[model samples]
Target: MNHDRSHALFTRASELLPGGVNSPVRAFKSVGGEPFFAQRAQGPYLFDVDGNRYIDYVGSWGPMIAGHAHPQVLDAVARTMRDGLSFGVPNPLEVTMAEAITSIVPSCEMVRMVNSGTEATLSAIRVARGATGRSRIVKFEGCYHGHGDSFLVKAGSGALTFGLPNSPGVPKALADLTLTLPYNDFEAATALFDEVGIDIAGLIIEPIVGNANCILPREGYLQHLRELCTRHGALLIFDEVMTGFRVALGGAQQRYGIAPDLSTFGKIIGGGMPVGAFGGRRDLMRQVAPSGPIYQAGTLSGNPVAMAAGLATLELIQAQGFHDALEASTHALCGGLEAAAREAGVAFHTTRAPGMFGLYFREGPVESFADALGSDAAKFGRFFHAMLERGVYLAPSAFEAGFMSSAHSEADIAATVDAARAAFAVVAAA
Candidate 1:
């Protein structure tokens, strides 16, 4: 496929934007190529500037559950835009959004909106510290909670894609306070909490580790964390930015039957718009600014446009069988791809949770960050390019998870599996 226009755009962008892209993974650095610029997206496909069409599996990094350019979401945003854009003041839609979220996720008695996942997570951490009067926070390795300063330690997503889990600018003092632990390891977490349980303010986790390629928690793992936090006087904060509505209507918490003390949401909550939120028990959320002592404010927190889009998206996902269909489609796609890899004699494996899934160029189950890294990166890069050439666009980096949309049809899955069959052959030869 000719990417002449995309190449020219990247050339200009490189001189203007760092790495010629707003996001690091979009640069395709880990996959050994320049990125393709998206001209437009509709349903389950992306049309690039070069006129190449691809069946999209990234789903705009897990927010397009209802799929791109859904008429309902677009109509809602358009209608809201006719009134005004940013009010910088309270709006009814904001209240509706808060109500909708709280109604869906019982753990969130109240919520505060922000512009991005990073803000939601950072603010959540602040609230935890303020409410508990503690200085230390715990996060898991390969579980990304956005790029907040405290979270950059052993973070996943773009940080892991570029081989820099610990960024340079974070101060040692701040980094020292952010404790890192392994996911799915109960003994280590138990031991750590026993040692410094008092100093730790909260434990933040992805619940389902999408950033490290969709690693699910082991049986009873989340319950263990909940128990430990309760015993340690630490808040359990679930970062559901990627999994919120995509995984299930109520998210991983509902699926696992565990309720956290606090939760952060983004991605699907915005319906492809820029939005984020942090919320929890009424008593804990009451501590946030204007309500109590803890301070957290945003100039455009409840922007009308974002709220409209989010509300519409949430409404659509709530329809009966929405999540069930999405989960089945994802399972079908992953299963087909695994069969293709087997036929091609490629050492490959995959994992899935509802609408989210992961592909690895390794054998057997990938349970942790170390296991994910053990997959052959070189093989993944080859397969990524091979699939891209065949009109199937997977996530640009191997470390990232792939998402499915309700808009994806069985025909799309069949076409994708056919492409994967050819791609796996190329990867096996490589």
Candidate 2:
């Protein structure tokens, strides 16, 4: 309940670090409060420096799927680090990770590891351009594929929360090369592809728009994109940095039964470490770096510690009924939140996938970026602080999706719902 220590830390940090945080959302700019600095996390709870414990739904922006500081993951990291930290040459863990990925997601025949989702996405687009020899890239309006220069145009997440969809300093020429389309719109996609499909190198999407608060693709929408890309000779890249391994075992592509030409991944694969990857059809991935002419390399591409943690996580998720339990938990959490809102006489809705969800201070059917923007963000901000005060940590911004983990027990979910009941009342009163 006390953020005094966090506040003191922020005072010192702000003097040296921009906004007193390494990441923008952590500043709580959208929620109108100073962020709490976490001391440690375990299971589904985060303990702040002030000794306050909160049930965590952000899951470190979607990597702690098995929960925070799982013994298995920690053990793997500890054991791997004992041998060495980084090796310039290829390590066996990297091969095992690649095997795990390719086997789980059949679409990724060959994968290249990177340090972050941003790097993976940047590398993917380059492969798209090099292979196709085209300059234009198409992305959806509310999909946040990291802060790559081209992706910042009409992006989501922190950019949307701050009202800077088109960030400054991106070259006008480069911005022009990146085209934007509304998600879940059939006609807009058709029209755009018809207009400049020839010039387009790739069309990348989030599969599930996690940044704009977890909007799902409409029926057959992904298939339509696949058809368009195939017909137009443009690569289809699924930016599954958020949805990968969270929505389903093989990500949204498998959940929706659509296959993409290239896919970029992060989050769960790292198991709370900093890692990312991009892979897809062999021909397309083969064009990246040493294999072909397109140059992309990372000094720590296959960090053994990260690989060990990720491999442990992958093993855990692959256990029987892991995804089924995850889906049930998501539904239970969303259903309870909706009921709590109803009891409080407040207008609220939630959109959910297997292990991720979005809360809106509005009615149902948040299918597009415009619908997401239509939510009462100011009211949501009030509710956010109220919930945080009650020991439930949702994502800092209404624009970001809240994650669920296999670590969250029914007791945790019930506690979260109870917290929401009181928090919703506060919102209603305000």
Candidate 3:
């Protein structure tokens, strides 16, 4: 529970890094505390510089599906790095990665690897615009597709956590081109497409809406979007960075049984390494460089080390009942937390999809951005610190989703529920 070393590190970091963290939410500004500096991570626990260990649910923002520092992933990295870090040319591992992605998600006939989710999304949008010869793109409120200029408008995650959904530097011109829609609202989508379908190049969405605290698509909602896009000639892009391989082997698209025109992937695809990819039907992907007119390039796009690590993780997850077990863990964790909240007489709800979940300080049925926003952020902030104090780490911001890993066991869940039992009492008292 002592964060003395962590505090000292933050003091030094504050002088160098903006907000004392590389990522915005890590500052814990929304949660009302300083962030803990991790010394090491093993299995499902994060060890801080103060030597305090925690049951980590952030899972490196959704990539550590197997767990932190899994031997398989580490060994893959060690072996791959021995050859060289970057080749400035094609590597066999990259080919293996591409094949793995395309095979797992059949919708991606061809995929382009990128350095980060932001890059993958930006490139996908460009492809959308270029392929269709249209100007506007559609994104939903409370859905974040990385920090690209086109995606910053009405964004989620850190933007929502800090109450700045629209960042300042994004130009008004660019903002105008990025249209926003309410998530899980079928009528709004139909109306918007009717109004601007001609000018719309693509409609990008996080089918699972992880940034908005894990809002699942309403029944048949994804099909409606697919139909609209098909009729209007606007490509449908699934930004599955967090959900890809985490929600299911084929991701949310697979779970939901929808095939998008374009798909962007990150997180688990890189297995905790910095990597991303976007692909879809061959004809559309063929338009992106070295094949057609549109150009997108990265010197370290398919870094061998990253590819090897990701491939290894993918192999582990492919084991029989991997996702089934992960899904059960999510249900168990959420059910226990809800029970603890009920016992404490605190209003609470949780939304889950396979390995990812959301915690809300409100009632159930959180199906839209507004519903997620209605959760009491202030109350959740208090609970966050209380849980952290008891050796459990949740996402720093209430707006971000929590992730579960294969490394987590029944004992870990029991200990977490025990922590929450006390934490919820703290919330009830507050």
Candidate 4:
């Protein structure tokens, strides 16, 4: 592929933006390549600055469930744009969006809108502290709930990609408020609660764990955590930013049959636009500013364009058989890839949960971040470039999950498996 345009663009971006990209992951630092600046995306395909087309599996990191530039969502945004964009004040769209969120996500009886996932997680943590009158919170090591100071103590995603799972700018005092433990470790979670359960304001986690490559909760783990949180009187906060509408319409709460006190949402809801939200029990949500003592504000909190896009996106996903079809496609891709890897003499273990999946170059199950790390990164990186050369796109890092959108059909899955088969051959031969 001709990367002349992408290479030049990266150089220009580095001179202007931090790390040559708006987001760290988009830099392609882990894969050692010039980031391909996207020209446009439609129907699960990304066209790059060089005009190379790729079958996109990242799906803008778990949004675009219905596909990029989906007509319904785009039309909503276009229609709303005619009304002007921001109004540093309330709008009917905001109210309607909140209602849509609450209707679909049962845990969110009341929710507050924010501009990004970071703000949503930060606000949720503050609300927890204010409502419980406590100072500390508990989060899993591999769970990425955006880049809030509390969430960054040992976040996944960008932090993991940079090899700095624990960032430096976060003060030790503030970091002290967050207790990070290995994900999917029930004993450790229980042990922490036993030692400092009384001091924990709340517990936050990505119930399906997309950040560490879709590591799922071990047998009844979520249910146990919910019960423990209740016993200790700490609120359970589910950071469903990646899984909200993609994993299931109601998210991990619906999939695992667990209800959290507070939940954060992003991605699919925005329909490829920028938006984030946090909501849960009506009483707890009432604690946020204008409702109670906790203070949180955003100038662009409920931008009409984003609201219209999100509402339209949510409505599309809520349509009949949306998730069922998405899930079936995801299973075909993940399952076929696993078989292909095995046939190619690759020591690979794969796992899937609804619309999300993890592909590990290992022999056994990946239950935690440490387990995920045991895989061969050098080989996986090689395989990534090989696949990219074949016009198939994956997440930049091995530690991130791959998303499947409703736009991905059986033909897309079949073509992806063919690409994976060829890529695996290259790595296995090397």
Candidate 5:
């Protein structure tokens, strides 16, 4: 467990980067260790700068669906790079990428690609507000929509990991306009809608809730949200940054059978590239930029490399039986983890929404952010270190979800399960 190289790099990074990490969660405060620096990654494996290799269950925060450095994505990026990197102008590849996304995700009739998930959600908020002609937006507790000022309130993931649910710089006026509600509470949702339904411009939610670890919509939850919004004249925005293309080809909406007015997408769509997009009904989307009055634009949004990578990934996903195979692999991995933990006498809870899964060191099931907090985080911390020591990498925090990719082999899944069995024993006995 000699992380001296990582420590040294962290020290150097601190002088230049905030908290020695570009992102807050990477600080590794949750797992109680210096963050390992990645040097190289291949399918299912991450080689750290300290020369340690770990099975990467984090998958670069759920972007590496085809697994790290997929040959197809690499080849596409290389070919696109030869033509050019960024032109700061239109490219034919952008058209192809947009077409691919619109064709796959039903909600996205027209999409605007952005550089990151935060940008996608932020721009979608603008679009929603403009289309609805109202100022207030409602977000849910523990459903992270990105770091935009409006979304920074009561957020999840890195914001929760760092103990800053609401960052300081956001204006109180802006925060006031944004309301935070609890997930899976139809009564709470409708109550708010009744209270300020007309004043509220839109409601953005994570249909499957991945940030507080894969919390699925209970019973008639999504349909309720959709119906309530439509009945109250408020728009429904689905922040599918994690669930999009990972949960299903049509994302959470298709998986759950509820279509949102607007949807934000990221992760696997770009095949490990920096990409995000937001779209919905064509008339609603026409509110953006050149189409209408609402303003949103990007410089390197449709970069040739990113577009090419995304196009290749989408093509592969649609090519004969990919989703079914990916689901079977994910089911095996999650089932094996559950069995291994049980055999090791561990009080662990597991939940999944397709390829994404969440593990908790708790006795009962978790359905909400409050329920997710009931997990034995101390136990999770020890389990994280145990797995990392055994060369099986997991998400650095208990709140983040774990992902299984199509590229993960049966042997890799078995190794991950075996490591979890040993790690569970270590934590349970302690």
Candidate 6:
């Protein structure tokens, strides 16, 4: 519990890096505390610089599906590093990665690699606009598709955590072109498409929203979007960066039985490394860069090290029963926490989709960003600190979803529930 070393590091970091962290949420601003610096991570736990051990549920923000430091992923990265790091040129590993992703997710007939989720989404929007010759884009409230300028309107995750839905630097002209709608609301989407469908270039969504704490689309919701886009001549782009391999092998699209015109992937694909991709129908993807004239390029798009790590992670998740087991574990953990909250007489609600889950300090279902806002942020902050004190590390912001890893065991879930039981009592008393 002593974070002396971490405190010292943060003091120095605050003078150097903005907010003393590379990422905003990592500063623990929403949770009312300084962040703990991670010394190392193993299967399902993070050992902090202060020597406190915690059962990790964030999974490095949804990329460590096979868990931290998996031997296979490590070995693959090590082997690839022996050859070289960044080629800035095409590598065979990149081709293999493309093949692996295409085989798993049928929607991605061809893919272009990028360094981060933001790049993948930004590039995807560009392709959609170029291919369709439209200037407007549509996104849902509380659904985050990285920090691209067009996506900053009503953005979730870190933006929501810090109360900055609209950042200062984005131009009004650009913001005016991006439309926002409510997720799971079919009538609003239908009405909007009817009005300006022709001007809309693309509609991007997180099929299973993780940024607003794992809100699942209502029954027939995704299908409705697909149909609307087809009718409107707008490309349906699924941003599956967090849910790609974690929700299911083929992702939310496969689970929902809906195929989008384009898709963006990140997190699990990199296996803890920094990587991302955007792909879709051969005709649409062909319009990008050297293949055609859409023009999207990256110097480290297909870094050998990233490809090797991604390929290995994909291979491991493809094993039989991988998703089934992960889903069951997530269900178990969420169910246990609900029971704990009930026994503690606390108002609590939770939602789960395969390996991803959310916790809310409110009653009943949370269906959208508006509903998510009703949850008690201050109360959840107390619960977060309580659990952290009990050796369980959750996503610091209440707006962020918690991820379960294949590396997590029943014991870890059980220990987490026990901690939650005690934490809920503290919140209830407050």
Better model by TM-score, 1 or 5? 1
TM of each candidate vs. truth:
0.97, 0.97, 0.97, 0.96, 0.96, 0.97
Candidate with the larger lDDT of 3 and 6 = 3
**Residue-by-residue lDDT tens digits, candidate 1, 1-430:** 8999999999999999999999899999999988999999999999999999999999889889989999999999999999999877789999999999999999999999999999999999999999999998889888988878888775433211212338989776788788878788898889889888999999999999988788999999999999999998999999999989888899999999999999999988899999999999999999999989999988999889998999999999999999999999989999999999999999999999899999999997899898998889899999999999999999988899999999999999999999999999999887
**What are the per-residue Cα lDDT tens digits for candidate 3 across 127-196?**
9999999988888888998888888875433211212237879887788788888898888889888888
Cα displacement (Å) at residue 189, model 3? 0.4
Listing every candidate in turn, what is its Cα RMSD in Å to the true structure after a full C-alpha superposition? 2.9, 2.8, 2.9, 3.0, 3.1, 2.9
Candidate 2 least-lDDT 10 residues: 156-165
Higher-ranked by lDDT: 2 or 4: 2
Clashing pairs in 3: none
Residue-level lDDT tens digits of model 2 in 202-248: 99999999998889999999999999999999999999999898889
Error of 5 at 389 (Å): 0.2
Cand. 6 TM to true fold = 0.97
Whole-model lDDT values for every prediction: 0.91, 0.91, 0.92, 0.86, 0.85, 0.91
TM-score of 4: 0.96
What is the lDDT for 62 in model 6? 88
Q: What is the lDDT of candidate 3?
A: 0.92
Give lDDT tens digits, candidate 6, residues 273-323. 999999999999999989799999888898899989999999999999999
Question: What are the runs in model 5 whose C-alpha is more than 4 Å off?
Answer: 155-165
Candidate 6, residue 129: Cα displacement in angstroms equals: 0.3
> What TM-score does candidate 1 reach?
0.97
Candidate 1 overall lDDT versus native: 0.91
Extract clashing residue pairs from model 6.
none
